[model samples]
Target: ELHLHTDHLNLTCSTFHDVHMIRWRLAIEEFGPTFHSVPGSSNVVADALSRLPITDEELEENPTVTMAAVEAAMSGEFTVDMRVIAAEQKNDKDIGESEEREIAGVLVLVHPKSKKILVPTRLRLRLVQNYHDLLLHPGAATMVITIGQVFYSRGIEPDERKLTDNYLACLKAKHPATRYGKLPPKSVEVCPWFEIADDLIGPYGRKRFRALTIIDTATRLIEILPATDATSMEAAYLMDRYWFARYPRPTRCIHDGGSEFKREFAELQDNYGVERVATMTRNHQANSVIERVHRVIVEKIRTKSINTQDEWANFLNDTMFAMRASNHSMLKVHRLSWHSDVTCWWALPTKQIGKRSINAR
Candidate 1:
């Protein structure tokens, strides 16, 4: 017969309330050993062995230690000593006569007005790596801006770009900067409302509300109307009530192949003499103008709706005003300003078109 001895006084009890203890008892029972309740003083050898220090060789062979070492190397911990930087700064000719300031108990060179630290040449790479990792590996421009907030280094932009370019994780996650093909030349529209694009934005919030998004391609002016559903009748109603009621009727209306733009929507466009141009299936690029605006509008609504997402409709007008007041990337002018300029330009005498028009060819 086998024998077992443990200092745990509860082990000798027949009844075990703990599931783990019961499982251990069942497992030990398989060996057919007699359990003995031993004095705590008799467990000296096992206790001493548990308290023994791990040797270097044992640590080297440990999988946990090896993994920790790998992690430490990858993380590139901050190891630059202030004394070392202070010593090296004296030799760095580029540092010039910059003022040295003791910040947070560490000696660092600081710019007079900006008060930003001037990092030593040898420490810049490690500093950049730590900042890059801490900020979750932002893009080069973002990294420069973040570093500039607290630290100043000459040619830091190129250094940051170089590091990010070589970083394997960043390489796998980031998109290539190269453009695949030449972008098609922009089409010049002389007047606003000549061509327009429309699309539906949501099914967002608790109400499952959606917004009908319409844009004037020439002026980049947008109109957003909230609806309870994405039905053809609702789309037509919003177009009639919001768009056609305010501005001049558009010649062509570009939209996706969704069923919401069919039936009643097609009939409404037909009656109004507006040609309905359905985008090619699965090709959103056909209506890229409105598609781009949709992203901006959704982002704004999402930001404003935060804890009150169910009331996204309440922020629609604010979103519209912000979009109209903001500068258009392509036109390089505010949407409202562009709309006003286009309207006034067309209002001028036809004789002045060739002489004084802003976009005269």
Candidate 2:
């Protein structure tokens, strides 16, 4: 019905079965509305809003006051309480006699006899699918609220426990777990405790570039190497040349399960007398140290690449320098501020700093 008033209904999927295509075409012809396909990324508003968690304050507030204020700010229109509107939707038979009626400043058509929400059958499926795609796959509770808003009633409720169970089943089927047969380092002082990896950056300019990031788990000292490719030879050469020259021979080296760290890379590790260890496949928590750093680096890249992403490689050094200078909660010290003479890496507290003549910079 919403699409009927509008010229077009935007869709995310382009292809469908022959039977579905025919049915959809016939529905559009009958309804006098066209369908336009759009990318998933374009549905940002629905995606973000669906994932937004409701606060305790929001739940306790009167819906009439809160919703009216929000609607007034957005559209200069007053709204009735959602509870009142819901009650009317459930029991108001007089409203169904009219072709359309306004609730909270929005016009909706009511069913003639049943007084249920009157939505076109074609749109009903699309509406449900969108809600599921954005909220239900994650088993979020927002689906219930969204259904009420679209259908103009709080009567449409789904079994949340069942939805969550189904979502978990699907998630497990898609990503099976891997076995971890070894234990982690006892403490940060342990040697050969590092995560070496690389990720791809955009096509914002001529071509996409690979960024090689290495981090020492103990010190949190980071090294960023921007390159053109992430091949096994490049990774091996980096370890042999840059890494080996600075640090002592390690007992173990942790590697992400990229093609760059495959058979030949394992041989390179053997040459250095380093036992190669791989992180659990597709598990971010297994390599959380590097994963956290990757997020920060990518965010910085996006922020600093306002003019052109061609020069993102140039900003890597400054970004990495800042990250290394920052304090780490785990280590209890600034990552790069440690000296060899210092036995303890614990940073001076703010209260202690005031009593000493310290030059932190």
Compared with the true structure, what per-residue lDDT tens digits does model 2 show for residues 1-361? 2232221233223344664553454333432343454455676676688799988788567332210111001111223334444455446554454456665676556655544455433343344444443221322344543354335333334343344346432343222222221223533333223334432223233345566676765456667766556677776766676667775455667666877787666788888787777865444445656666764554344333223334555566656655654444444444555544343334544333223222321
Off by over 4 Å in 2: 1-206, 306-310, 339-361
Residue 68 lDDT in model 2? 10
Candidate 1: the clashing residue pairs are none
The CA lDDT at 128 in model 2 is 44
Q: What is the C-alpha lDDT of each candidate?
A: 0.67, 0.48
Model 1, span 113-143: residue lDDT tens:
8988877787788777876654444557666
Candidate 1 wrong stretches, greater than 4 Å: 1-188, 306-310, 340-343, 346-361
Q: What TM-score fits each model?
A: 0.45, 0.41
Scored against the true structure, residue 214 in model 2 reaches a CA lDDT of: 68
